[model samples]
Target: MYFTFLGTGAGVPAKLRNTASMVLTMPEYQGDAWMFDCGEATQHQILHTSVKLSKIKKIFITHLHGDHIYGLPGVLGSRSFQGGDDQLTVFGPKGIKDFIEMSLSISSTYLKYPLEIIEIDEDGVIYEDKYFKVSAKELEHGITCYGYRIEEKDQPGTLLVDRLKAEGIMPGPIYREFKEKAAVTLPNGRTLNSSDYIGPDKKGRKIAVLGDTRICQAAVDLAEGVDVLIHESTFSHGMEEKAYDYFHSTSSQAAQTAKAANAAALILTHISSRFQEDDHLLLEEAREIFSPVYLAKDFWTYKID
Candidate 1:
């Protein structure tokens, strides 16, 4: 899994940054990619990377802000013309479906594939499958904004190769059966239990993506123990007043949420355009409060080992 910042600036575009947009890549899912906040001209940002429109199976919008969703129609429309045939599922706060439907309807744009939109509310599991589960929580934004928690499902225990070999089991279809917990009879007329040969279950990775909001306990709880946290730092510490006035978060505030959550790493994004001249300073401010802090930038990609 990895994250690529397609755009990091908030509200308005700057010379250095576009708007809010990020791509979460899951290599194990056949290069499946999920996007968070498709700001204006987001498809153009994908031009600089290897991200394919076809690979983007899901999109999560933080709010209904123009900067967060202006690029949705264009991206969705272009994908149909660009040979994308897979289903696209979009999850966001309420009014998301209406917005997408109106946009495509007004423009008379037809989609070549299935387009599904799920309006999010409250703090609970929004999506789940054999591979991953996505949850959402309400934030302290002035309006109805949400924070998302994406957790990979715990994987089955690793097969014990040594034990299998000791039992005279070679790597074959039988090994798959054993992994699947299918009953297998050993040469000695003894049944080998799958649980006995399977190691401990591997914990899945967790990532928290928060929308624009003030410092709130709900944010911390939603992001608890996340392997990576992508939080918005729309203002610097000294600009706390402005952040509060605008229902945004300061660098230190975002760091505090990550600290309380014990997140392994923090990627500060949705930066206010006001700090364009001193983007590094904004990053430094958050780093002072949190050790493993990264200020997101346009087209910046971070891979998780």
Candidate 2:
């Protein structure tokens, strides 16, 4: 899995940053990607990266702010023009359906693929499949905003090849049967349980991606024990009052939340244009409260291991 920041600026597009947008690429999902937020010029940003419009299977909108959603219609329409026939799903707050529909309708944009828009009125598991489960919780953004948690399902353990070899079972197609079946009967008429020849299950990774918001309990809950916590840090350390006034979070507050949640690492994004030159100060503020903290930049990609 990997996280690629398409645009990380807050409020408006700056010379160095665009706005709010990121892509989560899942190698296990056949190269499919999930987009979070579609700020203005987001499709343009994708042109500079390996992200494909056709490969974006889902879009998760944080809020209805222009910086977070203005590029959504363009992305959706362009996907069709690019011959993306796969079904696409979008999840967002209640008014998102109207915003998307209105934009596409007024522009007379036609999609070549099926589109499903889900307006989240409450918080819970919004999506689930065999490999992953996505849950949402409301955050303290003044407006209806959300934070999402992506939990990858645990995988089956590896087959004990050495033990099988000790039992005189050489590597062959029959070894595949040991993994697929609960019990495998050898050529010698010995029945062996598959569990006996398997190691412990591999724990899945968890990630939390939050929308623009002030420090809140919901953010901590959504990020609990996450391997990666992507949070917004719109201001520096001394701007706590200003951050709270604007319904945003400071670098220190974001780090505090990560520390409280016990997150393994923290990535601070949604940076304000004012701090473009002094961004290092923001990073330093966050690292004071939490270790392994990163300040995200546009087009930067982080591999999740």
Candidate 3:
């Protein structure tokens, strides 16, 4: 899996950064990518990257804020022009469905693919499949915003080739049956349980991505023990009061949440445009409270290990 930040500026677009937008690409999902918070000029930012508009299968809107969703309509419309025929699903807070529908209708934009919009009314599991599960929790923001926790399902263990060989089972097409079926019958008429020849299961990865918010327990809960915690750092350390008044988090506050949640790593994004040259101050503040913290930049991609 890899996280590519298309834009990371807060509130408005800047010369150095656009607005809030990122793509989570999963190799297991083929060419499909999941987008989070498509702000203004997001489609334009995608133009500078290798991410294809037609490959975006899902969009998760953090809030109804213009800075977080202004580019959504454009992105949705452009996907049609880019030959996107696969079904696309969008998950967001209440009123999101109305906003998308109104924009598309008013602009007379028709999609070539099936569109599914799910407005979240409560916090809990919003999406689940055989490979992964996604849950949401309300956060402390000026408006109703949410943080998402994505957990990949545990993978089955590898086939124990050495054990099978010890049992006189040579490598052959029958080895495939041992891995897929509960039991495999040998040529000698002996049936062997597949479980006995498999190693321990592999633990799956977890990631938490939060919208704009103040320091809150819900943020920590959503990020608990996650492999990566992507939190908004809209202000510097000394601007705690200003950050609280604006219903946004400071760099230190974001790090505090990460430390409290015991997150393996932290990626600070949604940077304010005011600190054009002093953005490093935010990174320094976060590192004081949490280790392995990163400041996201536009077009920068981070691979999840």
Candidate 4:
């Protein structure tokens, strides 16, 4: 799995950043990519990267803020023209449905694919399949916002072909039967247990992506033990007062949240345009509290380990 930042700026587009958007690529893990947010000109940003709009199966909106959703109508309409006819589901806060419906209705934009909008009002598992489970929780933001926790299901253990070969078992249809059943009877009347021929199960990775918010416990709950934590750092250190007054967070606050949750790595995004020329200041501040912190730039990609 991996992540591609489409727009890393906050509020408006800057010379180096756009707004707020992210694409989590999970082709090998889940066979498709999922978008975390779709900020202004996000569709335009996708054009500069390897992201495939057709492969975006689901979109999780953090809030109804314009910077986080202005490109939805354009992206949806373009997806249809690009031959993306598969179903696309969107999960967001209440009123997201109205905003999308009204925008599309007013602009006369149409999508050729089926669209599913799920408005969330509580915290719980919002989406689940055999491969992954997605949960959301409310965060302290200017408006009602959410953070998502993506937990991948544990994968089956590796089949020990070397062990079978040691027992004189050659590559044949029996290998297929061995994987499908717990125990299999060989042609020679011998019985084999699949458990004995399988390695330990590999635990799946966890990722937490939080929308714009101040330091809050809900953020900790959603980010606990996550492999990666994507948080907003709209300000620099020593600006905690201003950060809290505006319901945003500083680099130090973001780092504290990651440190508290024991996140393996922290990615800071939604950078304020005020730091347009000094984003390194924010990056440096976060590193003081949490090592391996990254300041997301537009089109930057991060591999999820």
| Winning model by lDDT | 2
Answer with 2 or 3, whichever has the higher lDDT.
2
User: Candidate 1 lDDT, tens digit per residue, 49-122?
Assistant: 88888889999999999899999999999889899999999999989999999999999999999999998866
For candidate 4, lDDT tens digit of each residue in 263-286?
999999999999988899999989
Q: Which regions of candidate 3 fall more than 4 Å away from where they truly are?
A: 162-166, 170-173
Estimate every model's Cα lDDT from 0 to 1: 0.90, 0.96, 0.95, 0.93
Taking all chains together, each candidate's TM-score versus the true structure is 0.96, 0.96, 0.96, 0.97
What's the CA RMSD of model 4 in angstroms? 1.2
Instruction: Name the candidate that leads on TM-score.
Output: 4
Give lDDT tens digits, candidate 2, residues 108-182: 999999999999999999999988999999999879999999999999899899998999889999889988999
User: What's the CA error at residue 194 for candidate 2, in Å?
Assistant: 1.1
Candidate 1 residue 12 Cα shift, in angstroms, is 0.5
What lDDT is reached at residue 271 by model 1?
85
